[model samples]
Target: MLLCSLVAIIPLLYSVDAEQSLSANGKVLELDESNFDLAISAFDFILVDFYAPWCGHCKRLSPQLDEAAPTLSSLKEPIVIAKVNADKFTRLARKYDIDGFPTLKVFMHGVPVEYKGPRKADLLVRYLKKFVAPDVSVLDSDSAISNFVEASGPHFPIFIGFGLNESMISKLAEKYKKKAWFSVAKDFSEDIMVSYDFDKVPALVSLHPSYNEQSIFYGPFEVEFLEDFIKQNLFPLVLPINQDTLKTLKDDERKIVLTFVEDETEESSKKIIKLLKAAASANRDLVFGYVGIKQWEDFTETFEANKKTPLPKMVIWDGDEEYFSVIGSERIDEEDQATQISRFLEGYKEGKTIKKRISGPSFLGFINSLIGIRTVYMIVFIVAVVMIIQTINKDDEEPPGVGTREQGDNASSSVSEAESKEYRSGEKED
Candidate 1:
C-alpha cells in the first residue's frame, strides 16, 4: 500500500502549483522552534508570520501577505517567508513576546524587528522597502525628469532621450543617475530616434569624453546599473590624458593604456582599480584612464546598442591611428594585464601586445543573453531527449499476462464448451 502511494509522484508534482499555497501567490515554507535557526540561516532575509490555526486575522492576512511576497522577493537578497504555529511552539510566542496573532518578525543580518497584527499588501511592500531599496521610481512631471537628467552629470553624466514624456525620462533619469553625462533629443523626431534608433524608453548613451568612444543603451535602466558603472569607469588610470599633454612627448613615443569596467559594486570595483594602477605605474608611456560604462551611458540613447560585448573592457586608441581592445573573459590579474598592455605597446618600446578585443555585451546584457536564449535551448533539448528515450524504453518492455488460453494443454480449460462461445465472447469474440 505504501509503495502504491509512491507510484504517481511525477503526476502529483505536475499537478501542484500556485493555488496550493494560501490565497497570496507566495512560496510558503513552514517553520517552528526546531527549525528556527535553519530557516534564519538559509535565507539572508526571513519574514516569520506567526499565527495560530484558529486565528481569524491570520486567514484574512494570508492572501495579503502572499501579494506582497513577490515584491519583497525581487530584492538583491531575497526574503523567505516562514509561517510558525504559535500554538505548538508556545515558547516562540513568549520569545517574540506574542501579544497577538499574525505577528511578523523580520530576521537575519542580526536582531529581529517585529511588527504585530496583519497588514495590507501595499503596507507590507512599504515595510519591506525600508529594509531593502526596491527598484522603483517616482515619476510625475517635466521638472522631475529635467532635474534627474541634469543631476546625473556631477554624479557622472546624464543620458536623456528628449521628446519622451517628462514622466518617462523621469523614470530613466532616476535610474541611471550615477554613471553618464545626460544625452537628450526631446522632440521625438527622426533626427533623434532614427539617428539613434532605440525602441526602449529613456535609453542611455555612454560617453568617454577623452577616448571619444561613446556607449549607449536603448532600454530601461536601473540604479543598480548606474551604481556599477560609476565604480568601474571612473579610475585615474582610465582618466583621459589631454592630447596637448601628449604633444610634449617625443614623436613615435606615447602609448595610452585604458581599462574599462562595468558599474560594479563599490568593493569589487575599487579592488580592480588598485591592481590596474600598479601595472600602469611600471610602464612609463602607457597612460592609464578609467571609464565607467554607466558614467559614459549618460548618452546611452546615442551610444547605439550592440548585443555582443565583454566585461572590464580595455581599449587603447593610440592617438587617432589605431585603437586596440580585448574583452572575452575578464582576468584582472596584474601580470597578465601588464603583459597584454606591454605587448600592445610593443615595437614602439618593447610595447605590450594589447589584443584588440571588441563587440562584447555589457555585464547585464551578457547575463540576460546567457540565461534567456542559451538556457532555454539547453532545457528544451534535454527534456526532448529524456522524453524520447522514456517512450522508446516503454515500447521495448513486453506486456505481462495474468491469464492465458490453452488451459491444461491450457486450451481445454481456457476455452469453454458450446463452441467455446463463453470464452470467445469473454475475450471479446474476434
Candidate 2:
C-alpha cells in the first residue's frame, strides 16, 4: 500500500541477490556470503525461510510463501524473505540452530526476534503479522488508494523548480477563493545539488528514492539544471508542505547557515549553549541545531514509528565514545543558553505540527522506477506475445510436425512404417 516497487538487477556473471529477487511474486530473496553484510543494513525486518526445492515440506511452503508475498510487505519496512540453499549456506544454517527442512526466523530491526515452524498459509500469516510495525498493517491498499484519488482533484497539478539555489515557491503563493494557491518553486541559488544515491554530494545526476521519503526537496539547486531535470525525469508534483511550515522565520535576506558542533560531553553542551546565545543575539534570524549520534537510536525510534518522520543521522560516528575528548567534559548550555532554544522552537510555525493530507505523486514516481521500468521486462513480454501470435498464424501453414492430412500420402505411409522411434524423440510428452 505504501507504494512498494521492489526491483531486481541480475549481474552479468549470473549471481543471484535476494533483494533483487524481491522483483516478483514467485522469486524469494537469497542471502549469500557477498551481500550478507549490506543486506543487514538495508531493511527493518527479514523473514528468512531457509529450505530446499526437493523436500516436500519445503515445496509446500514455497508456493504458500508466493501466495502471501504481497501481504508480507505491509510492514513499515517490509521484511526481505530470504531463501537460502542449505547446501550453499550450510554453515549459516548451523549458526542459527536450524536442523529441519523448513525453518523460518523473523528479524526485527536487524536483530533476530523469534522462530516459527512450518505451517499452512493462514497460521503462517497470523504468526508473521506480529513481527511488523503497527503502522504497516496489512490491508487492501489498491482499492483504498483508488478511492483516495477519487476524493482528490481532477487537475494533475505539477510544479517546476527554476534556479541555482531553490527558493520556497510558497513565497510566491497566489490568492484564490480567499486562500493561496500553491506555488511553483524555482532553484537558482548554489552551484551544487545533493542526492542520496551518490557516495559524495554532487554528480552528473542524483536520485532521491521514495522508500522512506515523506517529502522531497532532494535539491537545493540552481534554476537551469533544476528545470532541465524536471522536464526530463520527474512528473508534475504538488508541493504540499512548504518551507514556512518546516522552520520558523527563514529569510534569504540574510545568509542561512548550518554548522555541526562537536558536542560529546556535558561541558561541550554548555559551550554550544553559550555560542548559540551569542550568535542569536548578534544575528536575530539564523538557524542552528545539534546532531548527537550517541542519542540517535532513541531519537529515531519514536520519530520513525509514531510520528512517521525519518530520522536525521549525524555525519560523525564516534560521538558518544569521544564525547569528553571533544567537549572538555562539560555540558552544553548555561542557564540563558538553554532558555532561548526552548522559547524559539516551542511555538515556532516551522516546527508546528501540520495535519494536512500528504501528496502522493513523488512516491508513485519512485515506485514506478523500482518495479515498472525495465528494458529486459519489455523485451521478454514482447517476445512471448510474438511467439503466441506466430503459433496462431501457423494455422495451416504446414502439416502438424508428426501427423497431418496436408502431408503427401507417400510421406504419411513412410512415417507409419518407421515405427515412430524418431517421432517419439521429437514429440511433446504427456
Candidate 3:
C-alpha cells in the first residue's frame, strides 16, 4: 500500500511541474489567487503584473509582456513573466496593496519590489536583466567592456573603473548595486581612455550614455569620496523632468535648480540646458533639471509658471512643497542667459532668493499615488467609509442624561462590544 501511494504521488508531482512549465512556455503565465503563491515561490526571479482585464493600459501591456517573455525566459538565469487579473482577485490585489491597475512588481526570491522601469518590450527585458546581474561585472577585455556597456541599456548610470583593482569598488558596488551598474575593465587600450574621456588609468569614469555625458574622477578611492562621486553622478548633469524621471528623484536628497522653458525641442531650450549643465558640473551639491511648459503644463503650473512667465525661467526646488527664486536673476535674457544663470546661483548661495510654497500638491504625491483617477477614487471611498464609521461611533458614545445611569452603563457595554468586534475584524484582515 505504501509503495502504491509513493507511485501515485510521483506522477502527481511530475504533472504539477509539467503544468508550471507549460504555463511558462514562451509566454507570460496568467495567474490567480489559487496559483499565485505557488508560482511565485517556484521562481527565483519573476516579474508579476497586477492588472485589470478591463484596463486599456493592461490590454496594451499584455502583448508586450508576451513578446518579452520568451527572450527573458531563455536567459541563463531565467526570469518568468506573469500577471494576475487584479479585478478578479480583489483579495490578492489588496494583499499586495494594488491601488492601481497594470501595476508591475519584480519578485526576487519571493520578495517583491515595485518595478519603475519601462514597459516597452525591449526596454523591459534590458531593465529586468539588471535585477539578476551580479553586483559588479568583471570585464576582461576591451570588447567585453564595450559589450557590457551596450547591454547595460540607457536607464541606469554606469561606473567603469579602468586599470583599478576590483577590491577598491567591491563594497561600493554592493552598496549602490540597485541605483546603478558597476564594473571594472581589467584589460583595455588608450582608445578606451579617450573613448571615456579620462586622462589616465587608475581613474573611475561615470557614464550617463542616455544623457550623452561622462565624468571622470582620479580619486584616492576612499569610501567617502568614491561614494560621493557615485551618488552625485547617479543622475545626469542636467536631468530632463518627466513622469519617469520624477520617480527617480524620490530617493535623492539634493535640491533641484529647475528651469522652465517654453518648449524643450526648441534650440533655445537646448542652449539653456547646455548652460545648466556647466552650472551643474560646477555645483555638484545641487541637482539641475528642466521641464518645458508646453511639454508638462501641469507640473510647471505648480511652480506658478505660465505663458506670461519669462521663457527659460529658473528656480531652486527643495523637491517638496517649496522653491526659491533669486530676486535679480528672475529672468534670463537670450544673449545674457549664461551670465544670468551665474547670478542666479550666486544670489541663491548668498541668500538673495525668496522662498515660496508650491501652488499644488507635491509632485511626488502624484508619483506615489501611481495610477491617477482610479487611485483618487479609492482614496475618496476609503475616507468616506472612515468618516461614516466615526460618525456612528460618536453617536454611540454620546453622554447619557444625568438620571439615566443604568442606560449609560448599557450604552457603554454596547460600545465596548462594537469596538472589540472592529478590532478583531482588523486583526483578521491583517
Best by lDDT: 3
lDDT of each: 0.48, 0.38, 0.83
- Separate clash counts for every candidate: 64, 31, 0
Model 1: runs farther than 4 Å from truth? Answer: 1-26, 116-118, 134-430
Candidate order by decreasing TM-score: 3, 1, 2
Stretches off by above 4 angstroms in model 3 are 1-23, 360-375, 382-430
**C-alpha lDDT (0 to 100) for residue 308 of candidate 3:** 81
Model 3 lDDT on a 0 to 1 scale: 0.83
CA lDDT, candidate 1, residue 289:
58
Ranking by lDDT: 3, 1, 2
What TM-score quantifies how close candidate 1 is to the native fold?
A: 0.27
Model 1 misses residue 213 by how many Å? 46
| Model 2 stretches with alpha carbons more than 4 Å out | 1-27, 74-76, 134-430
